[model samples]
Target chain A: MTTKAKRSRLDLRNGRIDLSHGAGGCATDQLVKGIFHRAFDNDWLRAGNDQSAFAVPAGCMVMTTDSYVVSPLFFPGGNIGSLAVHGTINDIAMAGACPLYLSAGFIIEEGFPLADLNRIADAMGAASRAAGVPIITGDTKVVERGKADGVFISTSGIGMIRAGLDLRSDAARPGDAVIISGSIGDHGVAVMSKRENLDFDTDIISDCAALHGLVAAMVEVAGSSIRLMRDPTRGGLAATLNEIANASNVGLRIDEETIPIKPEVAAACELLGLDPLNVANEGKLVVLVAPEFANALLAVMRAHPLGAQAALIGHAEDDDHCFVQMATSFGGSRIVDWLWGEQLPRIC
Target chain B: MTTKAKRSRLDLRNGRIDLSHGAGGCATDQLVKGIFHRAFDNDWLRAGNDQSAFAVPAGCMVMTTDSYVVSPLFFPGGNIGSLAVHGTINDIAMAGACPLYLSAGFIIEEGFPLADLNRIADAMGAASRAAGVPIITGDTKVVERGKADGVFISTSGIGMIRAGLDLRSDAARPGDAVIISGSIGDHGVAVMSKRENLDFDTDIISDCAALHGLVAAMVEVAGSSIRLMRDPTRGGLAATLNEIANASNVGLRIDEETIPIKPEVAAACELLGLDPLNVANEGKLVVLVAPEFANALLAVMRAHPLGAQAALIGHAEDDDHCFVQMATSFGGSRIVDWLWGEQLPRIC
Candidate 1:
């Protein structure tokens, strides 16, 4: 039988995990053949070895790792599986690297639905396919009930940096322009909305996406003009901007009007008393571009699907201590401070 | 001030994190200085940027990521801080790679004791120092109480592989021998013994030393003989060998009496009804070597500090399906199964 056929032999829909499945014998074979190998199909995984061996591209390499612990297992728009894949890929891409391979670690809470896990595995497979990355090696452990949440996945990625690309946060300088791709707060709000007992909502979905493509496009255009790039994930826009400013030893002056925020997100923020600027965005990035190349860079960012809503929001200024200030919508000025308090815990 | 002094400027021991710390402002600066920066002291960290930039070496890179969540914050031999560093470093080393840089992410529970946090940070710093790897970049977040364990450390390591080294799990061939570095069940037993309740006593301390140094030595002496390497962590020796057998499309025949075990570990296993082979190990590895080089490899391993107790326990045999059979101390053969249930959860 073909590999796919063998992988599909198991009754995934109604499957239940038995002790033998985790044992290192025929049962383990059946599990991998019937499930994981099916979803995460590739030459490396099919090597059928405890460790994967493959050729590495020459020159500099970028390696990154991230762990996902979003609760409820299943969520709107995506699951833990896809999130794990995207999170690691984004980390690598943020370094101006082309993601190559991923290693996955699973901490499965006992009694989780086998079907849900299969679904998650399948989702991961789909994400890997889309990202052109593979889940090469993985470790799995099952935790007893009450000891762990449903499931926690940690994914580590390795990517190769293209020659001539020198991206680093310290590269940002005075007069560098600050840019953000798309509206912020979508991911945080979506997860918050799904969280139990938070009974408030607007029409919002997570902007969780694999962003290497967008980054690649930007790299192709901006190249050296792009000083640094960071995904505003847990700490949101304000924190990300502040981070760049501090790294470059420059002050930031952002025009609030130029910052992109979806109307629904703005309203939801108002109701929840959370600033859209401080809300976490899984799919957004804070980019520093030399002022001379801001126009060309903005145009290129706006050209990509992931960057359709990109905007040039701010510029760097000479300052001994990095400071972030914004022109308030009411013709006033305010410090765009980092997230204050536990604004929304576990929002990611 | 140099990066070290700047990092040490904050009050890590007495400081309580507030909203301003998470904010991208002065308070955040203090937090970074007093806590993370000091804990991970290095020139790359002193660059004081959102990311660390460095030159990559001229070889294939092996990268690994791990998240640490050991309850009780601290432990006998090492805390989660050290564990996080050792775990990923050992993982990369298993592939015969030289660890270079690491990225760390911390999720701290709100209201956790500052003193305790500092202790963990110091431990992390010390461990990184001992390993000769730097914590180049890191992130910290304060989650609301009950939203997370007191602390969770996510670490990722990047290492450079030597030019001629081509180690992989699939490289194990029929007639190859398997060897394990030291006794089984030390790490797992140490952790469980520290769990709340089930109060137990023994001189058993965690075998939590970093294995990169030993890996370097082993690879230097017997680079070609080695076919595969794995630190049988969670699922222990039985599961790891089984995985290698399956991955290599071979079967394993291990001499039970030949496997090394501490008398204390054996007694504990007998009393707890646990199979020592199934119990997890942290500071250990199962090495696959060609039969011709097995003795020489053993000599090299024994010459190292971490390998003096290393033992030649098994050999690979041709098999389409992987089977791990043990020659019992009683002069009979029995199947060594993969551990189905987690006898010890979160033992890492």
Candidate 2:
């Protein structure tokens, strides 16, 4: 049966997406069975129903969604496909949950190369399998030739949160400690370097990876003492800290000398007049924990590969204004307010 | 507190979407709070977290996703917003599941009108509320002008399936009965008339609605005796019936005089050289059930508002070729093959 079906397979080398693929006909069936079914092979997909039905344990479940429209589709360390999977997984991990299943939706432009689409789907499948999660169900649509870019992917994920776990953005206290996992601005700088056509001597790659393992380790060590966790993806650390300060109604004081930043990323930021604080990082996390468990959490984070360069750079304090201030290496203090306007667009 | 926040609200009257709205900064916060929060108000969204977590009973769960790229955004009866909500809810309902929540991802073009965005969100919220399903978590991104049409929305839904029901596409026997909930082709003809600027004397509104209520009634009457259910959306009834015949390895025989269609819709399809069976529908279903229970299910369906025009249009038979033949009003029989290629683009 498999050999018989393979005789009329899609033309992967020279084929391009067209309106017929989205028409819900024989052509649509061929596109789905030929490309998506082969790439994301699993039991649920083989069922071939309008929706996937499966058993789940009775517990608290977490759901998160994100859309990846990152330009240049391909980047230094990862493309949009792998980045989409990693981003959604990290969102689930921020809630101290065990990631379970995912659903994907793709909007492709007509005339887009089938080879590129195949590459993206294969990369996405690899990332999902590596994280122990499966893409159970998905959807695909084709727009006109110029109405969309190459492709835009939207992924939604669900996870299971164990008993007696409570994480909230407004749970931070005045005496909590602030820690960051690994360096900042690596993802933003790598994509920018390619988009701007800059000839930089030093090599920089995106810090795009799934952080569930690191998060699980941290939760194992300090589940009760942890206040909250957030991945600074879009507005970087500065915007995230500001949001936490306002949500928790506490002041944050940081020492700039202790923060971790890659030398190459810092150099690129300096040359482009971009601040490292407002740049994005896909694989890093900002943690707020009780002062007593700060060291234990940092030790556990450092033991993981994704958080090898974890650092404790700040602490919470009581203040009515809920301001976030940084003590510079030059013995001066300044407020790190939320970013005013667009510094980078489509930097996901 | 509400008044203070409203002072810095977005200008929805004459303002246009900009890159800053997707920058994950103060502007992004304003856009989210001012528009989305006001439209889709719920406790889960008010949590202000990256993900939504809640408890569920131990059971089988169903998941489905679809992306809407319908052109003209608005049509006679419904727009893309309402259609998106109805489409996803119906997908879950086909599995005899009760939909719990939905997550949305929107990619808007820069320079699009903010008023239009607000209208779409409000329509989507109303449709969701009407269906008893809430939009819990959502993400928004803005692309450069001309990179996309006005906006594209992707929605994913999760539902809980009852333990005793097992519906599938390949479960149909040789002598099952086929039923359609209501008339077809109204949706496609309505959208086509608007796009082509044809001034039809009679009104032809799209039959765009949520069919969960009708499905629930049918399941209550005949849960275990049902074989499968499908919604004829993109390629309409012909394509969907062809798929079922191929999956179940049976032949289908239908009477053309029994299938209901609005007169204006039939006239429009005839003028446009389109087959009514090939036109899309948003609020209809095709059901295959045990022959003994078909009359009971039809009686229950006719009691509901959405299925007032219900009819038993056809039956399944044993055939090696798995062909779908329709007995025409002219005393002739013809094969209804799968649609060969694109009929109407972006009709979803």
List lDDT for all candidates, in order: 0.75, 0.89
- Enumerate clash totals for all models, in the order shown: 4, 0
Residue B182, candidate 2: how far off, in angstroms? 0.2
TM-score of each: 0.87, 0.97
lDDT of 1: 0.75
Across A1-348, the per-residue lDDT of candidate 1 in tens digits comes to: 212232334567777654444433344566666667889998766765443545665567665655566755566678879887887788778888888888776655556667887899999999999999988866554445544466667677777776798887778888888899999888877777777535554457788899999999999988877888899876688878877877778899999998888888788777778888878777777888888888898898899999999998989999876778999999999877654335665554
Off by over 4 Å in 1: A1-37, A48-53, A71-76, A196-202, B1-33, B48-51, B70-73, B141-144, B196-202, B318-321
What docking class should model 2 receive?
medium
**Best TM-score among the predictions, by candidate number:** 2
lDDT of 2 by residue, A1-348 (tens): 211232355788999998888888877788877778788888787677768988999999999989899988988888889999999999999998899999888899999988898888898989999999899888889999999998999999999886788898898899899999999999999999988988889879999999999998999899889999999999899988988988899999998999999899999999988989999899999999999999999999999999899999999999878888999989999888788557778988
| lDDT score, candidate 2, position B126 | 95
After aligning candidate 2 to the native by TM-score, how far in Å is the CA of B129 from where it should be? 0.9
Question: How many angstroms is residue A214 displaced in model 2 relative to the true structure, after the best TM-score fit?
Answer: 1.1
Clashing pairs in 2: none
